[model samples]
Target: MTFKELIEQRAQEKNLLFVPMAHRFQEGKQVYRLGHVMLYLDRNVIFVFNGKTWVPTSLQSLLDMAG
Candidate 1:
């Protein structure tokens, strides 16, 4: 699925507002925000914003932690 689709599905499931960044995942910019969590994906690696910096994490880890 596309990034928008993924965001929509997760937002519906969690009953939260998720906003995708105005641009696609390129270089190292953030891609989306689920509630207050900002995330970036590049080269199959996911990085989550931890208030101070982007930390590498897995998709499963992110979902579990997010929930």
Candidate 2:
């Protein structure tokens, strides 16, 4: 799916909240999460909550893994 579609899908998920952050990074812009995954839109990464820190997942990597 496209970026916009991804964003829309995430928004539709009742358990997930799509929050935009002011912070900027080389990979992507900052985003906050109230769920297990923190999504960064700019870099296109998903930070899985590991009880402490967020883990990064590349969009391309996820797509490849999905296929």
Candidate 3:
């Protein structure tokens, strides 16, 4: 199975929330690499991928930035 599909299934099974990086940033899928499955635990607690590692960010801050 593809990475995206795999992640979707796993998220459903684990009851975890997931949103693709493409969708989260309001970008097109073609902008991101294929099979890029970046799933976070919840909307309140988001995990951001820096060049080195995943870092946590609050939903409120994310909302602020989006506006």
- Computed on alpha carbons, the lDDT of every model, listed in order, comes to 0.69, 0.49, 0.42
Could you tell me every candidate's TM-score relative to the true structure? 0.58, 0.38, 0.33
- Quote model 2's TM-score: 0.38
Task: Provide the clashing-pair count of each candidate structure.
Answer: 0, 3, 0
Which pairs of residues collide in candidate 3? none
Q: Which stretches of candidate 2 lie over 4 Å from their true place?
A: 13-15, 22-28, 34-37, 41-43, 57-67
Give the alpha carbon lDDT tens digit for every residue of 1-67 in model 1. Answer: 8754665686678776666778756365657876666787666676887888779886556666666
The better-scoring model by TM-score among 1 and 2 is 1
Taking every candidate in turn, the Cα RMSD to the unseen true structure, in Å, is: 3.3, 6.2, 11.0
Which stretch of 10 consecutive residues in model 1 shows the poorest summed lDDT?
23-32
Clashes of 3: 0
Give the runs in model 3 whose Cα sits over 4 Å from its true position.
21-67
